[model samples]
Target: MSHEYYRRGKNWFTAIGLLFCVMGGIVLIQQLLIWGIDFVEDFLFNAEFTNEKVSVAMLCFGIFMIALGFRKHEEKR
Candidate 1:
């Protein structure tokens, strides 16, 4: 029962992470198309957090969550 609950939790994490990744990717792509290469340069170097930066952060966080969800648990000796 506990294992099943853990599995369900992991599933939720993966699902949410996937959603975040998709949304972030879409927004990032849209920004790229609308703003051009200069935007990319700004995203790389600028200190201020912009919408594009938020999208990139979302993308990174989503990937991290996904990885965490899929990580294997070690058996206690």
Candidate 2:
């Protein structure tokens, strides 16, 4: 079989790993109330997460996890 076909199992594992990555990255988003980063109230109501710091943090975390997901997929290749 081709390398692509041979790598199917690895790709499955990578996808599973990516799920964990996304979960971990969004932990902050989940823990918003405890950390005072709740987006709904802070963003829409109080303009809380609308600030640069929170936005940047969220962006960095999201991008990092997404990059990690790609890296995980690549390793299987």
Report the C-alpha lDDT of model 1 over 1-77, residue by residue, as the tens digit. 56434433437677888999999999988888988878776875788777888888899989998997788765565
Candidate whose lDDT is highest: 1
Candidate 2, 2-34: lDDT as tens digits: 655434344443465556556645654555645
Indicate the residue-level lDDT of 2 in model 2: 61
TM-score of each: 0.73, 0.32
Cα lDDT computed for each candidate against the true fold: 0.81, 0.51
The ten-residue window of minimal lDDT in model 2 covers 5-14
**Candidate 2 ranges with C-alpha deviation above 4 Å:** 5-50, 72-77
RMSD of 2: 7.0
Q: Tell me the lDDT of candidate 1.
A: 0.81
What TM-score does candidate 1 get on C-alpha atoms?
Answer: 0.73
